[model samples]
Target: MKRLRYIALGVMVALLAWGYVAFNHWQREMIFMPSRAVGHTPPNGSFSDQWIDAPAAGGVEGGKVHAWWLPAASPEAPALLYLHGNADTLSTNVAAIDRLRQAGFAVLAIDYRGFGASAALLPEERSAYADARAAWQRLEQLAPRAVKRLAYGHSLGGAIAVELAATTPRVDGVVVEGSFTSVVDVAKSTEFDWMPLSLVVSQRFASDEKVAALKTPKLFIHCARDEVIPLRFGDRLYEQAGEPKSRLVIPGGDHNDCPAAAAGEWRDTLRRFGGISA
Candidate 1:
């Protein structure tokens, strides 16, 4: 009976230790500032690509931030500031680069600190917001003559885009794809909520609150078959936006494929927002 008590105590202690570890991991709010990576250039290669240094705004640790910019065919062309998803490097988005160019946008995609060659650590929602702001400032400086500026984000990037659209005045329009409602809400829906989620989740990436504050033209695209983030998150976000909002729901596409599946609608939405001839 004494041995049994010892075994139970050990199990309890182990569980407590695991809970503490999970809490710390979730709350390890690291901010990876974005940097530019020189990989494969654009396919059509119409625009000159380069990196610009900007200072981080609203970060836990204020420091220098960086972003990549591509020049347009003409000074009068509209500029696009893109924020990529969470995983992988920005170089992995060559297809998106090609598509944006075809859509008549001078693309500026920034690598959040931890993902690509960007300097910094991991990422938190606040850090992501600061990096995005710094990127936007650089875009303004690089394309001063451009008449319009649009913000685009994908997956995790979508959450950043929504936050910027709500808070920043630099962008005229916003585009988001495969974004979640809120990380905290999503965590609650998962089986891991019993874990110390709030303590470890440094970047909440809360779109539910931000979407309601968006005053600019916004386009949200989501996949009907997305296995990662449910389609309802997009629906909820769309409903929250005040006005000048549109949504594209791909019929059978999953998270990553939704963009390609709804390319026609996506282009149409962009054309409408950017006032392009397309």
Candidate 2:
């Protein structure tokens, strides 16, 4: 009986140690689900080919990140630097880009280091932020005289957008949709509620802290029916943000279809915030 007890104790310790290492190693994959195969190109040749120089830390060697720029109907129209969610490429956001285009804003959307046709490598939060900065620089060079420039992000991209808006001096406004306050808060709200995520998780895309520091005009959009990220997260972020902030709640909007659910309201709010003429 004593021998059997010792073996069981050894096995349990080994398993626990393995579990800890494995969880830490793969936590970023669980957070960012990059899909390379399901990407789509821009429609009708309306977009131009744009690329940003890769970050020095990128796993891929000597590669340029891909982006698409769809100019608005007029050259003097306001512009949007759109950062997409974690799972897919910029092509996955074609519809949203189209919506913004129709609302009279030039749209510049990029594929982060790992997603789409940019490069084949795992992306970290810091590298992703670097990619956003590079894209913003390219956008500035491409459209130096844009009437107004806004940073717009959805889901994980919302956190990225908040960071850019807070840090970048030229960004005029910010828009976030279906975004969370922080990765730690999101983990707490999900199945890993019991885990000490703040200690274990490596990525800290804390939008709440960044938004609180921002003084630009802000707009938050959330779907009440969003299952992936609760609407309260968006509300909490809005609360933390400084004044000149607005929010639009789509009553029946899910995580993916909020703009479609409230199309008119979505376009109108963006236009008003961006100061785009009718």
TM-scores for all predictions: 0.81, 0.89
lDDT of 1 by residue, 152-244 (tens): 998878888888877888788988888888777777887878967666665688888877767888888888999878888888778877788
**Model 2 ranges off by over 4 Å:** 1-24, 57-62
lDDT, model 1: 0.73
Candidate-wise lDDT, in order: 0.73, 0.85
Indicate the worst ten consecutive residues by lDDT in candidate 1: 28-37
For TM-score, the strongest prediction is: 2
- Top model by lDDT, which number? 2
Error of 2 at 62 (Å): 6.9
Per-candidate clashes come to: 7, 0
Candidate 2 matches the true fold with a TM-score of 0.89
lDDT of 2 at 137: 89
lDDT of 2 at 157: 93
Clashes of 1: 7
